[model samples]
Target: MKQLRANREKGMTLVELLAALVLVSLVVILINSVFLFTEKNADSLSKETDVQQNLLLGMKVLTKDVRSTDGEQVTVEKNRLLLGSDEYAAKNGQLLKNGQPVAGDIQSFEVCRPPKGAVYREDELACKPLIAGEADENRIIVILEGTANRAGKSRRLSAMINMER
Candidate 1:
């Protein structure tokens, strides 16, 4: 009887062993899932950061160009800004400037999509002009709007650019 009892207590019963194994497996799976979730969140954050940075840089370039515009003839022809001088034709895709294009930085500019029937605020799929007025002559206000995405969320940024005379 003593030998039999000792043998029985020497190892875990089959059912107990199975239950412990299942518990351990579950814990491992849970930990793995948590790690995966964290990794996904980090990836999303990285993408968001990239988009925000690009949007800001693009906006800065555009605003600088708009504000530095001189002798601007702004025509609100359905959300289109027809600015520049007679010498500079305000075409749909012209990069107008009084002087030559800036070496590395933009001097003056405008952004507009093709003129549709009504200037819908959301028809941004057309060839808009990124206009830049005279090199250092014009000074005006430029309004900009765009969407910046971050971590699966979208943010709208609107800014006004004022150029010095």
Candidate 2:
């Protein structure tokens, strides 16, 4: 007597195999894209941080000197500021006199004319005429413009130096 035998298949069909391969490939591609985007964002953030730090440091140093400008003659010309004291002179001017600083018997300060394309605005006190006029008891305003990067982001920082006697 002959017995009939049934065939059993235990493997996936070609279509199912192809579908799984495609899904896995898509997931891998999506993950890679996310990583790339994150990396780019991190790099941009770093650049911005660096720029901010530089600007802040510049402002702090300038502010300290301005606040300590006691008995110092303050001169403002366009974008420059000069603070002169008997001991030392602080200058932020465009032209240095005689390759040496312009000296004064008392403490003196000077700010150089700002470079072209730099924006500046002074307070009423700071803009007072340097002639035969009583010095105003108000503080001087000094605003400095920071260099912009390729991203077109710019920063402006200001310092106020009291001209109080």
Candidate 2 local lDDT, 48-146, one digit each (tens): 666556545545555565567763465555544556632222344212232344321111233332332323454321332443334333455555444
Candidate 1, RMSD to the unseen true structure: 9.6
lDDT of 1 by residue, 1-165 (tens): 899988878888889999999999999999999999999889877766654554455456545645555635434332334445422222322222343321212222333323223232333333344445422223223323223334334533334333335
Q: Any idea how many clashes model 2 has? A: 25
Q: How far off is residue 134 in model 1, in Å?
A: 23
The residue ranges of model 1 lying beyond 4 angstroms of the native Cα positions read: 71-153
Provide TM-scores for the models.
0.53, 0.53
**Candidate 2 accuracy as lDDT:** 0.49
- Evaluate all candidate structures by whole-model CA lDDT and list the values in order: 0.44, 0.49
Model 2: weakest 10-residue lDDT segment is 103-112
